[model samples]
Target: MENCKQEFEEVDVVFSKTKHLTKEECTKLQLQDSRLVSEFQASKLEIDAKKNWDLFYKRNETRFFKDRRWTTREFKELVNGGKSCSGKVLMEIGCGVGNLIFPLLEEEPNIFVHACDLSPRAIEFVKNHPSFSSDKINAFVCDITTDEITRQLELSCVDVVTLIFVLSAIHPQKFAICLENIYKLLKPGGIVLFRDYGLYDMAQLRFKAGHKISENFYMRQDGTRSYYFSIEFLRDLFTGAGFNIICNDYVHRRTINKKENLDVPRIFVQGKFQKPS
Candidate 1:
């Protein structure tokens, strides 16, 4: 339950739901819907703050990911795939306080990661981390829709676009632009690896009526927000932007409070979107 709250505060994304992918009609519908998109007209997009990300991490840091509950084993599989990241330049969108970045370095220490976040505080913490490497991990402040970071990462020349938990925060209208920017940054055939909240997880049901910011989008009392997604919407968004959807699936999760006999539902979507060769 609190995973929802922590999810928002950590990097501000999540709203889970999904039907069985095997359902024939549902699968067909998801494949054909192009105009489908969520509305987040009321959400905020700016992350103006001081250069230092210390206070930001201090307030939101958690050992949760240290348990590896959220990421599963997909990271290692791709990182060590037939294609290697040994000399590749990678860019991570919505990279919070180095939670995902530092561990990635541990996997392939020679590879460099160009990462950004809207929050200055988030960037600050990542820049100042103990494993922080000017050569391997370049942390910076950026907003995907408005910032010019492509030139800063020119030396690295991005080969991969990592979108872990990033898309849901963006206002709907800007999503296309976000994809466009990623495409521009990436080398041809570059892979965009991503994972985020799904459609009808318990978190979405927890929202009271007034919290709804738009269809399938909601804001908590905290500044954090979330958007539930249908698989079709994601396919259309990336496919229309010229990326091929290689893998997309819904994962159902259940959390148990053994002592209290409580079982909670959670859902997540994971995908590999690839630019054409």
Candidate 2:
């Protein structure tokens, strides 16, 4: 009777690796074997970043990226009590085609939005959008890493600055300068809602070795740059810029493709930092 009970209690289990790639396979699949770009070429790309972005907009027009439908759900502060709280001022840095801004305006029509992008063509698209209103949105082309940004918007007048997937496109060295510029424009207690690619995300892993511009930064064939962020680095960056970190965390998920037999892990870092009141 004891032996029979023991046999009945035994269980069989199966275990599988979360990711199937071996070290060599991963290296072969991800790393590019082509020669790295020369310093001169890299410099040219950096200087021509704006031109490249203009070309990008001209190529893809308004159909490249999907509208961010999750902003209201993720950031309730941007909308109070189901509708846009009146008189709130928002600046969407790197506002590409008014994706985020337009949706927010649809929900909260009373808020004023200041939208800027490095690409003039992108700003043009925003201005031409059917929903755009001159009174509701102030759209312009300004590179935040330069002094030109001040000419487009006044300092200390903005209530919230949204940096959605924008900072990663700028050089890491200029990150602090961009943040400082935003800080000068934010009102006391104003918040910056941030989201960007996180370190070791599938996008970064997909970069060829030669495309690597710097540590965790890569240049795509299209001439744009992308940088992956770590939670610690991002927290330090905002805090060092004089903002208090209210929240910082990684959003991770695994995407599976049955046809390709691929399981890709995507990581994004989302944070909210506020200027001291």
Q: Pick the candidate with the highest lDDT.
A: 2
Question: Where is the poorest 10-residue window by lDDT in model 2?
Answer: 9-18
Q: lDDT of each structure? A: 0.67, 0.84
Model 1: residue 181 alpha-carbon error in angstroms? 0.3
- State TM-scores per candidate: 0.76, 0.86
lDDT of 1: 0.67
Candidate 1 lDDT trough over 10 residues, lowest sum: 43-52
> How would you encode candidate 2's per-residue C-alpha lDDT over 120-208 as one tens digit per residue?
99999999999999999999999999978877778999999999999999989999999999999999999999988877677877776
Q: Could you tell me which residue pairs clash in candidate 2? A: 32-208, 32-209
Show pairs that collide, candidate 1.
16-198, 16-199, 16-200, 16-201, 17-198, 17-199, 17-200, 53-121, 53-124
Query: Mind sharing the TM-score for model 1?
Result: 0.76
